[model samples]
Target: MSKLLKFSAETGEKFLTYSLVSVGLGTVIAQVAPHVWFLDNYAGLFQLYKKGFAVEVPSHFETMLSEISDDLAIPVKNPLTRLLTVIGFDTMHFGTTSTTSGCFIGIPVNFNYKSEKDIDKLSIQVGNKSVPWDSKDGIELANSLILSDAAKRFGIAYELSLVDTFKFYLHCFSGPVIVIICGGVNNYFCNIFGLPYRPFPVKGVFYGLLIAFGIGFYYLSKDLITTYYEMQALKNVSKVGEEYITGGLEFYDKLLARNKALRNLLPDGSSEFNTDGDSIYLFRKKHVPITVKKQLLEKELEKLNHSNII
Candidate 1:
């Protein structure tokens, strides 16, 4: 019975010693572990998160637009077409010509007159000639064609802005959290071994848990941060959309006002002017000499090219 008691006491002491040693070692390792390779791989996690956010969010936004367009039976091939359709145009024709200087010039004109009578009565002319085109179908087609194209283009720009915001959030939030977790894990691991020696299976298990805890903490923090920023970005986008719509209305109002003012400058009963505020005035006047402007431009370019101050 005495021998048994001595054996039990010895066993107890050894267990306590082992436990203390293991814990001490674990604490040290946890502090240094983040500098190791496993933590380094966490960078890839951040990269993945960033890339995933970028790919998914924009795709989702586009998908929503596409579905809406499809449901409305709107053509989605060219955003402009979809915009035109939304604005109420049945048919649209758009064409562009390019200059030798690589500039593209586009001429877009919408016609609402469906019948010869409407065309003649409207007195609308294009390029010094009255349009042989007319429609009794009302001006909805022309208005729709113009508005739809504008709207689609605006939508594209909005989508791009959303994408940029998403990317910014991913980089700012996910990236830093991943880096922090990786760094912490490495620091913990390096502290684990005070001396160079092989790690036992049990020690390895504890180390793995420590790393996991660090990584888990980082992920949770990252998720929270990302969500917060995403919400903010979404709110901003909503505001941006509202602003765009309001601005568009204002722009059209100003444009129409300017057109009206110009029309008032024209002579009454002139076929060169239309009630819809379009003008088609042409005069066979001699071209103003371009020599002075050309000379001035040439001198400026020469000065710029030869400037020693850089």
Candidate 2:
């Protein structure tokens, strides 16, 4: 029985060690070569290319890129920040350009949907929440969501600002950090209370409690970090110019409007989204509330207007 207890302790230690090592390796891969796992569809690496979704990069998008780069003094040039058009509802940036390998930003095809056929294509794509409407209504809905040039620029700048930060790297390390801290705490408790030599039931409960605590801590910490950086990015991008300031406000307003439309259109509208159009999460949220985003930008716009008058 003594020999079995010793073996059990050793086995548990080995398992923890292996888990930590694997997570550390995964963190490294995610930071350096994220494309290995993420955006496979965007890269067309697996399965047949999604039809009618992959469109050529728009000419004006290039102009927006150049303008934003010049205004923000960020190097999001070709090869460093590759842009791809894919079928989706949102325009988003992936990975970071800080790595030698570069990163990608995806422009959703739905943003440019104009025709009846385009609306049909959008209806079938995944992640779409809109209820089926007539072709005329669909075109109107799509057009309503279509952002103006200034709003689009602000959106792109916001995305660029996020990728250009250490948020991604911090996100990668968050898991490992939580593991190391939790592991240390676990060890400390086990040694202090003689947990290892305790009966199986006691050990099981103790370890289970630690695992639960670790998961909670990890999410709370990550969400707080995400919220902080998201706000910081908003503030940073708002400083670019007055148009960007107004543009940022318009961007959030339009998004909220879109969400409101979706909430009415989706089957589970009231349950899935709040009246304000933000998705209602079960536990916690990683992104700032759209209402809050609009409020911040509105304040900035008011300040700019007052200053102009002065």
Q: Residues 1-310, candidate 1: write the lDDT tens digits.
A: 3686556545644664465445445543542343222333322232212223421222333454455344333334442311111111112111101111111111112222223343232433433544222332223222322333333333333333223333333423443455455545544544575211223565467556755765565546545554454344333333333333433333233334334443443345245434553444353212211232223334444554566357
Clashing pairs in 2: none
Candidate 2 per-residue lDDT over residues 114-190, each given as its tens digit = 44455554445213554455544344455556676788788888888777788777777787888888779878977
RMSD of every candidate to native, in Å, equals 25.0, 3.4
Clashes of 1: 37
TM-score of 1: 0.25
For each candidate in the order shown, give its overall lDDT on alpha carbons. Answer: 0.36, 0.72
Best by TM-score: 2
Model 1 regions lying over 4 Å from their true place: 1-159, 166-169, 172-180, 192-198, 214-218, 241-310
Cα deviation at 133, candidate 1, in Å, is 45
